[model samples]
Target: MKHVKIAGGLGFIGFHLAQKLLDEGWLVTAVDSLENRSELKLALEMELGRNAHFTFLQTKIEQVDFGDADVVVYAADNENRAALEAVLRKCQPDCLFVFLSTTDVYEYSGEWRVQPVTEYGKAMLAQEENIRVTCAETGGAAVIIRLPTVYGLHQPYHLKLGRQFVSYEDETGKTESMHDLLYIDDVTSALAAAMAIDSGQHTIHLGSGTSNPFERTGKSNGLDYQKAHELLGFFPRTSLAEGIKKYQLAHEEWQRQKKLAAMYDETKSMAAKHPNTNQ
Candidate 1:
């Protein structure tokens, strides 16, 4: 069982990916700040318990000691500098480093002459030099997955993915935003596949293919979602409807937890005022 280290494994994408790896018989080491206790993570911990071959360290990537892991998934970021620094420090001389970058970098914005990506895409444009320098110095093979807006069962509320549903009549409808919503499961599966590939193809677009380009309706971008089957060999198994249902459930659970916390706080305050209340 090859060990793979995910730097921000406590995050939405990383958390799901970690579970996928566990199912696939890989020894997984997940490192993250776990800034707040995530219900999904707690649930996973309970479900997987001692049987899962996993190690979760509650700390940032830069703080952890990267023991000799076969691959390093550089999922953590503290702006550009800290991001590159973590990679350089954690990567073994011959390790494969996979970076989860964004497709957002490709947009120059506006409805003008947009360029197709070459030598990996525009996502790496800003931090390209730093990435190259760090990888070169470490003698590590660096792979980059330029991904789009990922949505799935556990989509975090903090992503601010605009309003969930927008009607055509609504002036501020999300349909106008025109973004590709990549399923989280697809993202996780793609990374696991990339890790398995024994090739030098270090850069690949982990998207739902051109058929599912950023669009409100299929006609908006002249994209036919059906093409994902042929081109990317990827069809989102979970539809937006199913994914949103789960997301809504997570949101409701979070609200419930919040209310419980408030109620407990009030009870504690009352108890303090009446010291003999327990007696």
Candidate 2:
């Protein structure tokens, strides 16, 4: 069985990708610190734990034993740079190092802006360079993926809705910005396809490839994935309307679960206080 190690394995994208691989009968080791703790995080952890093929390691990135791993997918954004570099150095020649980088690697401008990297972009660029250099020297492979704004089930932010935030209060700052919107499943599929390529190096930009308004003022346009399609042999299958509908359904279910958990906790608290009075 192919072994894939995923950093930030409990995150929105990471969790979904791990689930996909696990379902496809791959052995997955998910490393996460759980620093960004949330109900969804815990729920995803529990869900992935149930799979016998999945291994959850609540630890730092550098500490993971990348022993015999066929693929390494770094899905985490905020990690110690030195530690990440050290991890890259540890990758063996046969390992395929996959980095989930952001389009933020470019200057702040339109959706496809290039050159003059931002601070975060510089950091990602450095990591990509590290992956490439390390792999080139060791005869390993590396796939650096630049992603746009991604949303789906377990989505923490509602970038397009503008009406509500998924995991934050409505009073939060305006999320109105132009971006290339992508569904989570499409991303996972692209990442999976990237895993198939085990030689040389590649950098792929995955997105709708259009600077659509971030707010849901009107119908989000259909995607044109010709770039990803021609290159990766995959294109986004979910339409914006369909993706939004799925998110809405999942959010409603999450809210219901949250309420039930709160009610259960309240009942337990009451029972604890009245324990001695019960006949």
Return the TM-score for each candidate structure. 0.67, 0.80
| Model 2: per-residue Cα lDDT over 1-279, one tens digit each | 999999889988899999999999999999988877776788888889999999999988888888579999988754357767767777888888888876656544323455534566666777777777777777878888877678888766544353222222342542212335677888999999899988889888776644343534434432346666776887777766777788788879978978997899999999888787646
Worst lDDT run of 10 residues, candidate 1, spans 169-178
Cand. 1 Cα-lDDT = 0.61
Error of 1 at 38 (Å): 5.1
Tens digit of lDDT per residue, candidate 1, span 1-279?
A: 899888877666787888888899988888877677776676555444554698888876677767578877876652456756765677677677777765544443332122424323343554545666777776667666666667655545333333333223333412111235666777787788667543242545544434334344554222223433343455556555666666677669867866887799899999898888554
- CA lDDT, candidate 1, residue 164: 37
Worst lDDT run of 10 residues, candidate 2, spans 162-171
What local lDDT does model 2 show for residue 144? 83
| Count of clashes, each model | 0, 0
Off by over 4 Å in 1: 37-50, 78-80, 108-124, 158-178, 198-201, 210-214, 217-279
